[model samples]
Target: MATEGSNSPLRFASVEASVPKITIQFCIQCKWNLRAAYYAQELLQTFSTSLGEVSLRPSTGGVFIVTLETFNQHSVLESHTIWDRKRDGGFPETKELKKKVRDIIDPQRDLGHVDGKKSATNPPAHPANAGHTRELKDVAAQVVDGPVKVSKLQDNRPESLGVQLVQAQNSSKSQDKAECEDCK
Candidate 1:
């Protein structure tokens, strides 16, 4: 039996101390703590294990900067500014921020729709379901009567219903075109 007070020979877990650190310095006078906190939450959520620490430093002068610090091959700490409000001309969108961080931590990651392009490697969340095409078309045929409630269309429907709905709606608008090029 193992004693409760005994010093165990093994340590259960360990954390990597060499992971990169992220710092968001926002203007305290401008009350940008919430903005900084939002970015921190996003980064932590997206790269939970990839980051060592995320710090929110209060600053002044309309400053909003995001810096990533990592040790180089030579063991020298190097800091890179990912985003600077003044230099970038404005605040970054959530998707844009995610892409920026993803590029640094995991470049091969697929952000799907956030990447703004549809490729074989990064396909849509839901593809068209041929088996349900007739049902989707029937729903699309309702446009002749009046405007349809797309929100209510997804109830008790397949996960790919939205993609089909968009295609159906668009095709109805332009009968000559059966494809939804802008579905994404």
Candidate 2:
């Protein structure tokens, strides 16, 4: 047994420096706790030194928000809505989530291939978009290389046209579902 004043090895308690905190509020009703926790773990692991804590808060409704706060001050510095079932209709991609968090925590950080522009420019030879990526690249090249003339419509704007198209597609999908159900 070591005595009180024995010549034993001196041991020092490890002290961890506190950094900023990140809070992820996930909706319990929407069953997004696992998704939120996974994101929290990813963020914590990525920014271990820069982050002090990552907390998860269960909320009602369909809210999936990520908030960054100061550890010592306990004040929220920035917040981002990672997902909103009612508003966005679906969950965000992992890359998108990482980009949002990176923007808040470390603005200048590079996410390599996860960045949209980089991936868009150097698209993989996969059937992910069914060659739509090439078409988009061509359109983008055309737009950048020359002055594109926009034909103005008398009663419709581009934004309104997009909204109308989306509404039409949604209505058609609902009709298709109804027709399928009738057939069954």
User: Which candidate comes out best when scored by lDDT?
Assistant: 1
Error of 1 at 2 (Å): 40
Tens-place lDDT digits, model 2, residues 18-43: 44667777777556789988988877
Clashes of each: 0, 0
Candidate 1 C-alpha lDDT tens digits along 115-147:
886656754444555446666676767765555
- Candidate 1 Cα errors over 4 Å, as ranges: 1-18, 117-184
Compared with the true structure, all predictions reach lDDT values of 0.75, 0.61
- What TM-score does each of the candidates earn? 0.53, 0.44
In candidate 2, residue 104 scores what lDDT? 65
Highest TM-score scorer: 1
Cα misplacement distance, residue 153 of candidate 1 (Å): 20
